[model samples]
Target: MNTGNSPLAAGRARLGALSLAITGVLFLLYPLVRPYADEKSMQGAEAMASPAWVAAHLFGAVGFIFLALGLLGLRIALRETAAEPLASRAVVVTWIGAGLTLLYFGAEDFSLNAIGQRAVNEQNLKLLVELTEAVRYNPAAITVFGAGLVLLAVGVILAAVAVWRSGLLPRWSGVPLALGFALFIPQFFGTPAMRIAHGLLITAGSLWLASSLWRAQRR
Candidate 1:
């Protein structure tokens, strides 16, 4: 078989489809299952310290990992298409975004877990607030984290543009996913229901894109 028609390509297609689907599911679950509490307040300390908190953030980190892998597969699938250039760019941006975002996620997962646990044990609400602020507001940390999210938004947007341009796939397939990423930063300020709704949006986008890509491969 020609290299382009090899099993590897099919494997990648399936993997990408599965990865996208999984990413959507994970993202939805992250906010859904995470313990919610006002992190700055004494009453909320236990929620932050709980395993659920770490697990919630970890869902996001893992989802990003899946997204990066899915994009790589998508780039391969888009090869020779009009959208290839944009898909290529999206791959790079998404990968870099995943890396930078993961760094902050790591801190959130481990550091906050530690801090919350210690604060709970010592009954030090002030210490919890102070240390959490110090970590979150660190100039370098916050900047990189912010940049990562912005880049991720850009990446998804680029992917959406590519999908719109690709004749082989449904033009609107990427829209919901793109919208979810675009609103990611703002969603934190929204109500819990709003966040959950955002998760649903991502899931819808992922399913839309995955179905289109999968069908393209079948044809």
Candidate 2:
């Protein structure tokens, strides 16, 4: 139960700190390289068919995974501290968020890629729009996806709170990261440029926090 000298535990702690840096880079690239267009048209289908589309979505999915891992690492680092409870809750919420987010990303990346390929092969671009709508509008898929994103926001906010009160870490370390997650859903309505900017914000925030976590681990 003590885990004080557990090699596996120590490894996880290290990886968790490193995960934030990886997540930051991936999140920054997700939107920048993504093929963006009006997804309701032929051009949209073409964009979807491109390798970049899949790569972009995959980046997002993988980023979420690493983000959750990083949060878990943070929780471990906070163990036995006053902030432990909040960090633990943050990990749970973020893990759930990452799971839900990945489900939607799976549909977006793989399913849509298939649909795009099929549409391109058939020379019937309308299929891309139709199929995409059907899949995206699925009640269950959307509900969970929405919930997941919101939970991500909540989880990060909790992490920020924990960091703020930790007394062992910089109070401002989690602010930018929390703000970035909080804006995740609303940014969907923004322009492509705005999305890119959003990515930058997340990148900065994540890297900042990652620096703190890395230092914490070394101490």
Candidate 3:
């Protein structure tokens, strides 16, 4: 039996652990940039116009990239760990979810932000607000974005459960991973507190995963 770690496996474990840690740290800082009001309102437009707002989306975009990469690494790591079929499947699903979410977020961070910023520069608050609402609630966008969010949440929960069952890491880490995404349910209520709480939970879960993977890699 080949018991030693292959170069590719080792690289994946290390990179995945690092990427997850970066993602968690970025998420922890996200609350600072998150707007407290509607993006289309006068106050909302003013908030988005600030340097902090721009930094927030940029940070979030980078975080999404790291998150997707981390998921890919985790999938590869799980495969090398000889995790059960269910665990492998869950990781695969998580990867897909990460990809989908990244796509949605990338658009919001780059395209939407640019348009909103332009509207702000032109002093057209109405256009900025309209654009924000349209992007968020457009029928097609809503469908696809909503699907991505659902997949992300479900994938995280499933992956957590699989990790627990497979004993790939400390089983207790799975609880936070599952509970973190579960907290997202309350965010639909559109409260800042709920959104902040959700982000915190997910960040905690990501950190836990990162720490576990880092330890495993060192071993």
Candidate 4:
């Protein structure tokens, strides 16, 4: 919206600030979740059912941070780029998808934490076994997993398109966001490899976005 010098420049400036803030928050979330990633905790369905491990995971907190940052950044990015029709549309859609995903993941995080906690304390390994088996055999986990994959896909698509059209960020930055999207899907359906791949993608994307924003300010 001609934000470079328009009255909305103030808002655009604010958006830039918000985006940078979110990027910083996301960076901080990494260390918070690191300590809980012990191998035995996630080894199998049995391990996953451990209340001590599951509750400690605090995975929801991470999802919440991402969701919050994504929502704020989306608002700012869209507002700043509104004049550019293509970028605006892409960003808006991406943000919407990202917002929904944030909600979805947030809910899942809560559910896992709450329910998972009970299983751990109850020592009801039997129930835990059943639930894990359901996740493996029943279609719900598959369905939900697919849904998460779709949200990530949509967000990445929108982000990729917006970044490409706006050229607001370096071409290098877009590369990681694009790659993150590509790797995220496979990671959802794959094994430990997927976790490592998706983790790298998330890290790369966050860094790129943060770097772009920092560089833009310097210019």
Best by lDDT: 2
Global lDDT of each candidate: 0.86, 0.88, 0.68, 0.49
TM-score of every candidate relative to the true structure:
0.95, 0.93, 0.81, 0.64
Model 2 C-alpha lDDT per residue in residues 27-133, reported as the tens digit of each score: 99999999988887777878888999999998999999999999988888777578889999999999999899889999999899889888878888678878998
Q: Which is superior by TM-score, 2 or 4?
A: 2
Better of 1 and 2 by lDDT: 2
- Candidate 4 lDDT, tens digit per residue, 1-219? 243533354445445545534543443443333333322243332344445433433443344345335434433444555324554454545555554445445444445454445566775656555654554445655555556556556655555566665655565655565566556556545554455556656566766665665455345
136-206 per-residue lDDT for model 1 (tens digits): 88999999999999999999999989988877678888888999999988998898899999989988888
For all predictions, the C-alpha RMSD in Å is 2.1, 2.6, 3.0, 4.8
| Candidate 3, residue 65: how far the Cα is off, in Å | 2.8
Which candidate wins on TM-score? Answer: 1
Clashes within 3 Å, all models in order: 0, 0, 1, 2
What TM-score number comes out for model 3?
A: 0.81
lDDT of 3 by residue, 14-126 (tens): 79888888987777677656666676666676676566676776676677567667766666656644454555566566667666666767666666666667786788887
